[model samples]
Target: MKLADKHTPTKEVKYGKALGGFVVAVNISMLLCLVTENLFSYGAAFVSLVGTLALFFDVMITLQFILLVLEIWSRFSRLNAALQDALYPHCTELFVGASPSYRCSLLQLQKTYVALGRAADHLMSHFGLPMAFDIAFCICGATCSSYEVLVKLLSDSDVPGLSIGMPVSISEVWLALHWLRILLLSLSCAAVEDTAAATGVILIRASVVPQRRTAEFDEFLRFTLHGPRTSFSAAGFVKIDRRLIVSALTVVVTYLIILGQLTFK
Candidate 1:
């Protein structure tokens, strides 16, 4: 996909590796914390082992989805940056104008971007349900724990007693950590769309030669803006944030339904 002479994308590659490693570390830390909590609270190694395995499964499920999203994002960013560096400021690569290699590069990039969009949709289709439930569990745990602490504090009505069974500060910190996790997850998902859309803008400038441009350049730019899969939203309806909200509501409704059934029984 090289139209102009340039060095390898070592920087972006390094960044992706670093970010991936960081995500793995953070998630593994979370898994270990859960396993440790269960071990101490239950005093049963088998129970903790089972719970650890379950959590580790969920972690892998969600982690793979997240890693794919990051990969798509990094690719889009790399594409845009390469386009800019090749044809920006002085528009130096204007001589490559109408060349087959240049056109082929653009065509290949467009195809790759479309493939990315399809992959995004597939990711949503394959892992979306599990991820939604996994996140819902986190939110539910945070909400329930906070409610328990508040209720107990109100009943005891004293700082020392409130801090006895559950350390008040630690509880607050734990709740805050989950909330932060949710926030970061949402933001990272959003960046996919942002980076994907920027590709078209870069192409418009990179492909054009001031006042002179070819049909292929125009077509690619137009395709970018109006293509079926311009970005993460191939259907224009697969927004992660919206899905997360729907997932949250589903979780709440199911909880209520179970409570109702149990009370009636």
Candidate 2:
């Protein structure tokens, strides 16, 4: 297809806009709250501005990454749709292996699938450094935010000056947003593999239900058997799957425990 004929999805664009607007509004609101609390002191104003800028940039990068993930997922979804459409007519038991055209079509689709898998891995590789930093940012931020929340709730101190510049409500939102972003990142990355698995299912269904044993399908099965290796990962060090979210939250919890012990002791 021509580049012009392929258009960006309108719904995704609207979603991107909504996310960007929300991030901007939240950052601005947080900064305003900080500035108000500090009585607009010059030093606090400078610090809030710097912090807001850094936060805004960080969230924007994450948002862009999410949008990219959604786009890739859409492509994989379209691949599934294409598979169904292309093979529906030829997917009968006795006729599937007899058609030369079916084999050709399957070969083409296998190429598309392989290309998408490699592209997803390459995209992950490209973002590896940023992902490591982003996860680290989330880990530290979540730890502090959770600590603030716990201090507000569990501590016996009634002093207003105990907060580390952030209100408990803001800390709650901060903690939720950080995890939500990371969770979305992990789920979206993992969806690529899930969608790829759906393709495998389509092929396997053909073989299982109709018994279409062909050379092309065997080749395709061979590739799918190795699909997990091509899944998105963090510079080949760690996978960007549901487990990553679990691991990240585990780290946050461990630190939260340590901080609680030290503070409460």
Candidate 3:
């Protein structure tokens, strides 16, 4: 699709406005939940109490994941384009020996790619596992809460020997499977990034020093340059914007911590 058709200015404005509104709503909901849970904990109805808590935690986690993915994807795509532009013949370094900026830019791009790959790795290792656990926990919590409601209703029917300590439900298993799907998606991303990082580093080192160091540089370059795969053909590391990565991950971790306080305690 054409760029204009894909991302019109008006569409961007609409999305930005919607995002701001969503953030406001999220903050308001969190504050309200905190206040209600504390001040009128006893007065709140069971359904409202359980549903609101579930929703609050789920939304926070979902938002954090979405924001992180968007941030990484957008920045990575930009860096990819920048590298493509830099590699063009017209974008020559005027003073190859003295051009620190040229080398720095290339290195910076490579570093960003590495950062993206690292972030992807973290997502696969740490966040992915936690997300799976969280999904299971939330599902189990919901099932137990539902059983509590059901048991309470049944107790009022004058049943004599229908006593169960807690209901065992299979919702957690369902959620665990869902979490597995998400993990698989992230795992695919991680594998791609791992390959990119490994190959990029080798290529970047070879590109930097062809004759002075590394006997295999020539052979490596020849293979990489002529490789059928587009990704392996590239010379530099993936360029990621550190500021964006840090900011996104910070937001994610912060929200997760806040969510923990709001939920577990």
Most accurate candidate by lDDT: 2
Predictions in order: lDDT: 0.61, 0.69, 0.43
Best by TM-score: 2
Where is model 2 more than 4 Å wrong at Cα?
1-43, 92-100, 155-165, 209-211
Model 1 accuracy (lDDT, Cα): 0.61
Better of 1 and 3 by lDDT: 1
What TM-score does model 1 achieve against the real structure?
Answer: 0.72
- lDDT (Cα, 0-100) at 226 in candidate 1: 86
Instruction: Put down candidate 3 lDDT per residue, 1-265, tens digits, no spaces.
Output: 1221222111232243465455447545544544354434344577666766765675566456545544444445555455444444322443343244445555555455546655655544445554545444543443444444444455566755445443222223333333333332343334344444445444554355323222333344454445433121001222222232343335445655564354434
Q: Report the backbone clash tally of model 2.
A: 0
Model 1 residue 250 lDDT?
A: 63
List the candidates ranked by TM-score, beginning with the highest: 2, 1, 3
lDDT against true structure, model 2: 0.69
Report the Cα lDDT for residue 151, model 1: 46
Q: Estimate, for each residue in 179-225, the C-alpha lDDT of model 2 and write its tens digit.
A: 87778778878876798788888876766645456788778877777
